[model samples]
Target: MPLSLLLSLLAPPLCLACGAAAQVHQPLCGRCRGGLRWLPPEQAGAGVPLWAAVSYEGPARALVRALKFRGAVALADAMAAQMAANAPPGLLESRALVPVPMHPARRRRRGFNQAKEIAAALGRRCGLPLADCLERPAGAARGSQVGLGREERLSALTGSVRFRRGAAVPLRALLVDDVVTTGATFAACAVALAHAGVRDVGGIAYARTPGR
Candidate 1:
């Protein structure tokens, strides 16, 4: 049998949320996908205008957890579709799609930067150039930010990221991430991109947690 089929037969793919049989390379089944609540864009504080596809709840939250923690990388394609669907008008015209960078150590532990995967998928979907323009300091501290408030996240992430040297940064770029919580990471990325000479910065994420 083909490897994929063999694996599926041995360990049938199941939905991350409801344990239903999952489609090939997808974390959620059709019914679980239908449970992802769409969220409309609104003014999220300064720096860059942000757009998000779904609220960080229900099946959307489970999908993100699967991608982030369980190495269900294929879900990136699904998440990218949502990102593209919720993209702000004219954002598809951005010069490049830049993923929020993870510190090299953290990325090493995770074996992949989920944001980069999501950004690359989004770029393919939207036909925008993909760029790895930001680099988090290798020694930046690591911890769960789940309970931290907005200002706390900003304080923790302060001085944590900078533009990668010699990386091409376009005049207008869209920062991409799997989720947006406090917007601190996006704000920091905008500052880094601005320092590297990007004139305009906008952001897109698969999910957002309101009032975080």
Candidate 2:
């Protein structure tokens, strides 16, 4: 039997946005999915041109929270699907999807890196390569970026990012993240990639904090 059919027989699927009956692999019901506010291609900040799949609001927010904190691994593929659907033109044309790396200790405690999860899913769906180009030091400080000013966040992150040793950086790449706030983290990552010989840097996040 097909995997989707088998899974459906085991448990009826529910919408990721609202707990309503949903088809196999469909995380959001029509109403909730229609409510998502996809941003325009030009709506990017920081020094790099970025594209976010959805505003960090409503169903999108709930979806990201589920993936980031609640261990909803299946949602990674769903979110990637949304990203692929909403991606700007030429996004998939990049050499590979480079996920923002998590600190080793935090990733160990969490048992996974959400950004890598999302990037892997996106790569599988879009046929793009997955590049684990950047990494954070195990000793890097781990704390919330919330409530910090842009310069403060940048200062906290500076010199903490480094390109993976022995990995050849692409000339152009898309930095994948689950969320983008002040673009501080993205800027830091782009800087590291630039130092590693990556020229053109772009980004794709599942959601962006609105009104920032």
Candidate 3:
């Protein structure tokens, strides 16, 4: 066995996928790594090139669940590290990061926007600014759960999100989120940004549900 492999065999690593105490990277174990479905650039997205750091399995699922359901803001940094490692180098061009916004009512109940929190963390790591360029309707929701077709998703939030009120116009942006189940949501966000006259919209997420 190679010296490194032999050492790993002797030491055994903790399962990074599930926090199981082993001896390797405390977060990602060899088994979990093997199971992770890291996508090639072709599968990420044709127009935007979706960037994902790890497969949504083992610890990755747990981490996303913990962050989303368990209110784990602390996990953002670790997640951001993964983004730093895997995100496209061009993602941070002249554009800043803008996380998909949650409805005010939902955000009020949750006390935070998880996507925004993640974008903030990633923005810090990438040394870029963040912009809240879009908003959901007063009582509407935008996501896979919303049950809207792609065309509807494009204009669903039309009146909801105000245009870029900031001094900057003709800016570029990268939208962020925890997971993308369908291309609908991201495409819709792109539509909204386009309506607002902003060019150059790309996206990044922690995970993507396979297939439509």
Against the true structure, what is every candidate's RMSD?
2.3, 2.3, 7.5
Query: In candidate 3, which residue pairs get closer than 3 Å at backbone N, Cα or C atoms, i.e. clash?
Result: 12-23, 13-23, 13-24, 14-22, 14-23, 14-24, 16-27, 16-28, 16-29, 17-59
Say what the RMSD of model 3 is: 7.5
lDDT of each: 0.84, 0.87, 0.68
The runs of at least 3 residues in candidate 1 whose Cα sits more than 4 Å from the true structure, single-residue gaps closed, are 1-6, 9-12
Score every model by TM-score. Answer: 0.89, 0.92, 0.75
lDDT of predicted model 1 = 0.84
Tell me the deviation in Å of residue 57 in model 1.
1.1
Per-residue alpha-carbon lDDT of candidate 2 for residues 1-212, written as tens digits (9 for 90 to 100): 96656867899987877889887777778888889998888865677788888899998988898887877777899999988987877787856889999999888888899999999999999888999989998778768887889899998898888899999778888899999888888899999999988988888899999997
Write model 3 residue lDDT over 84-184, tens digit each, in one string: 77766676566778887777887888888888988898889888888877777665644454676655755654455544455354478888888775555
Which residues of candidate 3, in runs, are more than 4 Å off?
1-17, 22-35, 44-49, 141-170
- Write one digit per residue (lDDT tens) for candidate 1, span 1-212: 75656887789798889998987777789998888888766657445788888889989999899899988777899899877777667777856999999989888899999999999998888888899989888777668888887788888887788888888769899888998887889998898888889998988888888554
What CA RMSD would candidate 2 show? 2.3
Clashing pairs in 1: none
Top lDDT hit: 2
